[model samples]
Target: MKKFILILSVIFLIHTASAQLYIAPGADLRLAGNVQVTLQNTDLINDGAISVPATGRFIFNGNGNNQISGASVPYFSELEIAKTGTGLLTLANDIRVAGKILFTSNLIDMGNFYIDLGSTGYLDGEDENSRITATGTGEVLSTVTLNAPSGANPGNLGAVITSSQNLGSTVIQRGHQSQVNTHGTGSSILRYYDITPSNNTGLNATLRIYYFDAEKNNLDENTFELFKSDDNVNWTNVGQSARNTSMNYTEQTGLNSFSRWTLSNAAAALPVTGLKLSGQWKNGAAWLEWITQTEYHNSHFNVERKYEDDLNFFIVGRKNSAHPGGNSNTLTTYHWLDHPLSNKGPVQYRIQQQSLDGATAYSNIIAIRPDVNSQFIVSMYPTLHVKDGIYLKTGGLQVEKMHVRIVDMSGRLMMTREMNYQSGWLKLPQLAGGAYKVSIKSGDHHWEGSFVKD
Candidate 1:
């Protein structure tokens, strides 16, 4: 019962009259065809090997739940998938190839599978070389596994996994599931193997898994967790690794196996540890300040403010991040000022920290009630006067009562008066004037101006 079909070094053709071919599970077969294979079903448990010629096409109809548990033998020639149905093809086993593996199938289910590539192998869809594309309407989960050469603790490979959204271009990688909340329509999930650096061997000496949001931007490191699986059914938490926030990628320190890896839960994360943010008001302006005890690839800070009881905030100012005394461990201080807060009520403030790579975080929101008097603008005129008298003007949001006081440089009170008009004129007693300070107080609002009489 030796069930094997070897079409080696010969021109072999497989053209079924009914446009369909079915191979049983127990039939262990090997193929080296030079023609197109259409409408074929190699049922479950068929661990056959395929070796198509350079000009041949091994086409599979993606209609039913197809399974490919075969190797590409010595090399892969032209393997095509005609996406005629809506079902998925699960690569339950490894398919090591050194040639092209194209997919016409709209979707390839990989939530519990892997596409293990040879040391010099890569996957190519119709869009680009070294890319695996998804053209389906439903969500597609894809993961690529790479192992270090010679089974080293940490190795590298030259492989690229690229896919677009179901509609447009929203490329996502491991650890960015949070993006699906906003950009879920045209999105696909991509996962990769993480590797460390020891005896560097491959072209790209590092195996990195980039985590990006639905907007094609790198995701923050603190927003996700990493997990690994051996059987693809039961997964184990591998703990989140130290991320390169400025680069929006996490580098696995001591991983070398060919297991399935994933990045999940990409929601908003709190400010990094040892970060302190505060706000204050001075001279009719709101000032925001933050201090970080340590930093890593920190990019910039955005200051935002929200009106009373409003949950949404808008950016009002931005400050570039600077290291503390030329290093990252020292306490770094940053500040920004937002003058004339929009109509003076209870204003809330928060700082948004953005890393150079694309990671992001937010500080605790702080609220401050600005002085209602800030809405009133006070102005006074006249330096050297005798009869014209000094004019006092109070504009913007009229006040019921405003008290004015004139004091000498030596703290001697010269005159005090109260007015209710929006504009008024005051006559000060004749005095040997060198410098004097005029103070105006209206409710909780106070303003001070200076003048010198000759």
Candidate 2:
């Protein structure tokens, strides 16, 4: 154990030594006044963070994260940092640069370097001017214990990040890096990229915004503003975040913005989960038809019902879901029994769409006036306004021998035909060019419709 401890101490000393850079007699480092690095190697591996000798001024020139991986490059005794537009050094792997990690582009690959403030010693990445870019393959650990910044300590900030990785799996897991809005724009400026639903309907999303105020650790909350857009260009703020008050919020309402949820009603919501939202819908009373492009095995959507006078909703139904290992799936139609809805005047319904992972989404508001399918029937067979001479032959069910009657808007039967109980065609008699309704009926089967015989 003592040997191991000694080895660990030596390693720590080496790490500290790597950044104690100094300027050499003849070397060029750009950007900062001068940087002194000690190590220079072209064959460095990426197993862990490497160190650069901090000695003099030098410039690692290239665009974005560029590096010179060759043998014949001249070696500089002391390194330099240049501000030639974007003369930046990005560690493809972790690396250490002792001295001051200062530059016009105040971005330091945190995996490689740490700040050890000595007397008159201070490390800063903020010029309050340059933009910082954090790097990572999956999750980059840039552990930074900021001595904190002055002026605008912990301030609210907003960000809009897009994912176009080749792997197509850009998972922004929670605990990898800390975020702060050093910009201090403090007007609650909204910022976020757009996300369309699977069928371009609506997204079952979980909204999470992290903030680091006063330059301390990041702060989280349960409430946040949620918005959605049909096109990426235009957006509509769904509503204010109303979840975990202090640190989190979940859309316990099981909904984000849908095609028609906005402008519906403000009171139709539940307590927030953590300022985040998620949902998926599978079963309900009435059979609904729509296309779903993406599918998550998360919790299937809910079948919620609201009775007359009682503005509150209660879950009355549920449906199982498939596992979420694929990118997309579709459910042509979703049906619900809806026995929970009492015959009271106007009852409401909406799907509580949830993901297998607990994310939530919702459907459009659909209302049913008790016994609509039975009591308040609609006529279809001989629909008026249909083109002239268009024969009506009901295909699916037994329509051959049914009582078919055409009627005027004032409930006047102009023509009648006894359709056979099998497949047969119904020809209409010649009439003046006008509109009329058609009604078809059989034993216990009655249907009416409108038609246009021009």
Candidate 3:
């Protein structure tokens, strides 16, 4: 028994000497100051909290395994898993860093942990700032945590992280990364991150992004794009982020699959100022009215609507913007009327602003329902004045034939036309500028409408 106890003591002492880590009960092992710790060809195990300061550097460079459990606070410093050997580091704790945490050519197993980029830290491929660049093909079973920046300097809030390897998940708290504002007078600001969402969650994987102006106090009305890519080079604008009013943060949720997300203010100076859309039931019709503040290189506005169960929005009306004031700083008011064939229970409406250069943006979505009884009815397009012909739809109702007539204000029939059940359009004869009445009849069904000829 004594011989066996001696052998066990020897083994414990050998491991204690080889590890070289300060082990304590309920105390953290810290690598502070300008300390440089290198794991050349062996595994390093730490059971207590591991704290590394900004001036400290931790390098893993061997074929052995390194495991850190309790908690790791690498505050605004550099940590590298070098390319020398097949090093595998398992971090089970929640790590908070403000500098670079890289995997040059090794592996890092996060074991479903969280890595918090507390103040500022990015993953790899950075030029002027610290980056988190992981070039290895290793697997990361970890989640990224991004806190909201509440400081005066917004540039220290957001992270510019990019990884060649796929990431598991990301959580963003409400925060601001303030870049100096040259708003209304300078080049637009842009920030983008490249990441590949693991197919483990399929395309239903969610990425939550919280955004606020880093330097500016109030959130400016700006445009942001969420882009996705299969190859890191080619990108597709998946969708736009929606502003969350309660949190005062632009929260972009519902990102299923992605290779990257890029947010930019292409037309930052062309502030939206104010945008509001409301619908009301008036004389069996739904009236939609909206107002816009500042507009630049504005082309037109498209009124779009969707039903409760529908996932797609259809353009219902169009209003040309004659920003007559030309890049006006004044408010512009617009209106549209929707005469639905059927009064649906719930319907959503929004305005799509198209720029002269074909770029487009959307206003906040508004949902409203008809106050009166809902039923299928025939409706027409271009209910307002038009220079060309008009389209009439039966709201998908069955009609043997359609008979249409146009008359002048004096009640004299100016023209008459007939259409089959599958017909779509009715051409009108040129008339002087005046209001006219249009009547359509099919068996017992009848619809009387009016329009102004331009």
| Best-performing candidate as measured by lDDT | 3
TM-score per candidate, in order? 0.33, 0.29, 0.37
lDDT of 1 by residue, 217-253 (tens): 3434455445444543233333444555555554444
Where does candidate 2 have its weakest 10-residue lDDT segment? Answer: 260-269
Q: Give the RMSD in angstroms, all C-alphas superposed, for model 1.
A: 19.5
Please state the error at residue 108 of candidate 3 in Å.
14
Give the poorly placed runs of model 2, Cα more than 4 Å off: 1-189, 193-388, 395-400
Sort by lDDT, top down from the best: 3, 1, 2
Worst 10 residues of 3 by lDDT: 174-183
Q: CA lDDT of 194 in candidate 2? A: 24
Candidate 1 weakest ten by summed lDDT: 179-188
Residue-wise C-alpha lDDT for candidate 2, range 1-454, written one tens digit per residue? 5334533443354344232122222332232334532222112222212223434433433233333221222233233333344444444333322333344442333232222222222223433333223333212211211221121111111111211211121111111232211111111211122222222213233333332232112222332444333532222335543444443222222343333111111111121111111122224234433233333233465777775445587787785444344123233244445554222334577666665345465555666653333221322344445554445434344333667687777776678777565434466677777777665666656544456765
Q: In model 1, which runs have C-alpha deviations exceeding 4 angstroms?
A: 1-27, 40-44, 48-57, 69-78, 126-454
